[model samples]
Target: PDIELHPSDKAASFSLVLKGTSDSRTTAYKDPARIYGSSHSEFTARKRLEITANGLRALAAEVKVHETNNEILGADTDVGGLFAGMARNTAMKKARERIPDAEALAARRVRERVASRLNQEVDASVTSINRRLRQGPGAALEQHGLGPASLAAHSTSKELVVEASLLFANQLAAGSPPAALPKGARAVVQIHESAVNNAIDQLGLAGQTIEGAHVRERIAQALAPVFGTSVKLPDDPEQQAPEGSITFAARAPLRVRFVDGQIEVILHAASLQRGNLKTPAQVIRARYQPVLAENRVTLRRQGDVEIRAAEISPEVVSISLQGFAAARDAAIGAALRAPMDRVFRPQINSPKAFTITTELGNVVPLEVTALESRDGWLTLAVR
Candidate 1:
């Protein structure tokens, strides 16, 4: 539904009217249930906005001052000055409400959105979808692309509920209880009562939204792009993925990130070891960070040992070398003259193999499984 706003300087002038449904039938978003329900209310957009509260505060404060000055002017000035005061007050009031508190609120909203995806929402949503995909009469886990060894697995009969459901307040707390009733949830999601509590015990949720433009860019990456604006899930629920192939405009640089997957790589260019570093570092390191988990790699350099740039599976497990030694890319450039200092391992497992290659692949076997993996994204294929 197209909403054509009347440009007027009065509270009475700015009011919303729903075009499609009765007042009783609208969703909490006041959206009518239509198959093609593309039209969303401005109120709905404002709800997700991080700065709505601050804008309201700024408005109330500014308006009180504006109205008060108009009164003082009426007492002291000529009718002309009084009329001018009224006009200024009206114009300011209209502009103030119309123009959102973009800067301060934008910053806060982005933080909230990223937090929702990372700390609160993304995991729940993935669980919901995975549950739905898992459902069926005797549905095989392989049908959903999951093998039997998926650590703890969800049953095929299970269903899940995941949605953004815009709200201005009480966006569910970090790890709150499951939603009491599912709204606008798909039939694919069979979240019923008796099992709801149990499911909540088994599953988890985090809060999230599309907030900062930069945050939006990150959300787009961590979660794949659904449309121009919507986000889909990454391969790993607990990991933040990089923006796939989105070009950034000069005015708006694209930054790929997510709420909880704080995987980033930084590089310093030394004329001694300067390479096409920063961009590649962020790219390659993220490629492996999900593999690195939260652990830092501590290399023991007996004397300038060779390191190979390795590949992580698209699902972030099992590194299949395009045959290892062919990877001559400089993993690090340490001179043997300096008594060979190993790159300090943070959460990195101590990988020692014949030449760090061979089938032992040293770090590859040790770093790939959950027992040795850090943070939340690691798995080992049970033999």
Candidate 2:
């Protein structure tokens, strides 16, 4: 099959809402310990933020300051200290309750104090998204994507609200389909073994090994767009079967295995080849490791699949090449690099959106109201 590639100037508009609560405790006065008792105040703030291509904006925020409790844990009839603690606690509580919108007022004061640091955080997040969507494989976002970024926030009696719009260059592409959820449908994905197996089969390696002579033909057919003119698979099995073909003994079996924490497609006795250098097939396993472990594929709970370093066992595995073992090992590792770094591993028969027991409504795309990871599934609420 022949295919043509074209540059896409298409863009997507989605809203990401982040909501959470923060708990804080601090000493009311710096020298409280010297007074034979500790006086401390505790506060809780509930914050909601709306983030868009424009920037991050506060939705609503609510803050509450608990009355100070100035009491010594152990005291030998320290009547003065006891009364002082009681009086201070009573006074603070009364003052806070007596005022209208006290929590909102307090939240405003807190926001003002941390405004500079908060703005910096928002800026940093926007910068990161911009950098990711504008570089290398991510550059498919086209040119000058994110626009006119700005942040706005305010406090209310119930909570503090933040709204941000990160303006980027975008135009509605012609006849673009809306990613709306089907009527009465939900947004939960269950990635089963069959779905994974099918994806692997699409790679044309279901019954073949990387060392096969015809591997390049299969790879070229599957990934012509990626490797392009530089594509090559120089290593061939020692025992040849036919021209541009691999021996039946060199074939490997592939299966998707579901383990305790994640799902993996294991290619038994797979071959790893870089140019003319070949390494053991087991060296090509894809374990979803963390981002810090950049050597391996960065697999997070987000369900996105990435290519990373496979595991290498201590057991002596045979190398096909006669010389340059160390250099060949490195070369083999480089060749097995992930073809697609970040891609949504879609679940078969997945829902468009989902509703959580805690949330009042269904979550959908365009507006991702909520996100939860439960029962090994990443559940998302969309609007």
Candidate 3:
């Protein structure tokens, strides 16, 4: 490839053609990987081709720089001849002669270079998406108070779509989902995971669900002597245990389920662990609704926000939160102890107050209709 650059005040430019031929008997040798059932030979060939291509590019650049210098310094044509002689020295001649087929190698390099460039462009385009905008509908939007924490992008004919299950993790203000983009431009997006996680954290539930069998297993593990080798319990999400008991240690994943004005928790081993048990496995089947409520704290799902005693309002450019005391304490602790986790956190907390905020940068207005829960994320739907 040859390129010409116009002279600037500080420099001059020259066009140079990389001359090479692609016909070579050496490449007739089959890449060993194709025969040996491995890709090693193919990889080796690609590396060699890249190295050769880069060397040629450097050589061409050096020649151009010298040419520019000669023109700038007001040197005559004789100086150009001197540079040509130096570039065509014995080493250059031998390097060219040693190559089996320069043109064939250059051809491979061109294809690889073009493919690399396209891959880079695709990555850049996908990463450009704005978080608050571009939520699409699917099974990912079947639940309330769910919004995508991140997106996995795949290219389409003119836009990119996420065909996989997307996890949502935050609350959104009740309104239309944000629009995707204008036409005739590369479609891409960025997701705000931390912002969503913060909004969802107010609920104290974070949509965590565990089956009864899992709870049983955890209890058995805690009381290994009484439960023996294995433990069994119901696997249904809505099913509860009756007339059973088991003990477990603290810090097990406690799940809270809210139905009407009541709250039920599973995997809570605090009460059972206090007594000695003969039927340890059988005791694990009891499901008790706990009388747990925080003063001035409300847990409810509205659109994409899980209410946990906070005042949140969504605007065209930003979502505002006030008086989320619990979320504030947790975030501050996380920031002070595990500061590394906040390195890429997009949601910003105000030092002056417990108010948190995040903004949508330059996106079209769209309506958000539904939110669904996925593992670690919520999916948002636009209508």
Assess each prediction's global lDDT (C-alpha) against the native: 0.24, 0.36, 0.28
lDDT of 1: 0.24
- Model 1 residue 107 distance off true place after TM-score fit, in angstroms: 43
Candidate 2 achieves a global lDDT of 0.36
In model 3, where do residues sit more than 4 Å from their true spots? 1-102, 105-153, 163-180, 183-383
TM-score of each: 0.15, 0.27, 0.18
lDDT of 1 by residue, 1-383 (tens): 12223332221111112222111111111111111111111111111111111111111000000110010111111225548566545544543343243223433444344334332332343344445434531143233222222111111222221221111122221222233322332222211121221222121111222222233244334322112123432232333332222222222121122113232221111112122322121111121233323443331112222222333345743356443423324433222112111111123333222122322133322232221222322212110
**Best-to-worst ranking by lDDT:** 2, 3, 1
For 1-383, candidate 2 gives per-residue lDDT tens digits of 11112222221122222232333432233222221233333444444343334433343334344443333322222235558676555545544453344444444555544444444554465566556444532342122232213434433332223332322234111121123323332232223343233333434454454434454355445433221223333332433422222211233344444444444543344444444544454422333322212122223433433333244543643555334555655554445433212111222122323344312234423433433322333223344
**Predicted structure with the largest lDDT when compared to the true one:** 2
What is candidate 3's local distance difference test score?
0.28
Instruction: Name the candidate, 1 or 2, with the larger TM-score value.
Output: 2
lDDT of 2 at 5: 21
What are the runs in model 1 whose C-alpha is more than 4 Å off? 1-256, 259-327, 330-383
Model 3 lDDT per residue over 1-383, tens place? 33333332222222323332222122222221111111011111111011111111111122111110000111112224557455334333444453445434444554465345434543343333221122322122323333333433322223334322223333332222234443333222222333332332332332233232343444333322211223332233433332223233233323333333223223322332111322111101112222212221222222211212112234522434434544663443332222111111212121111222322233443333333332222333332
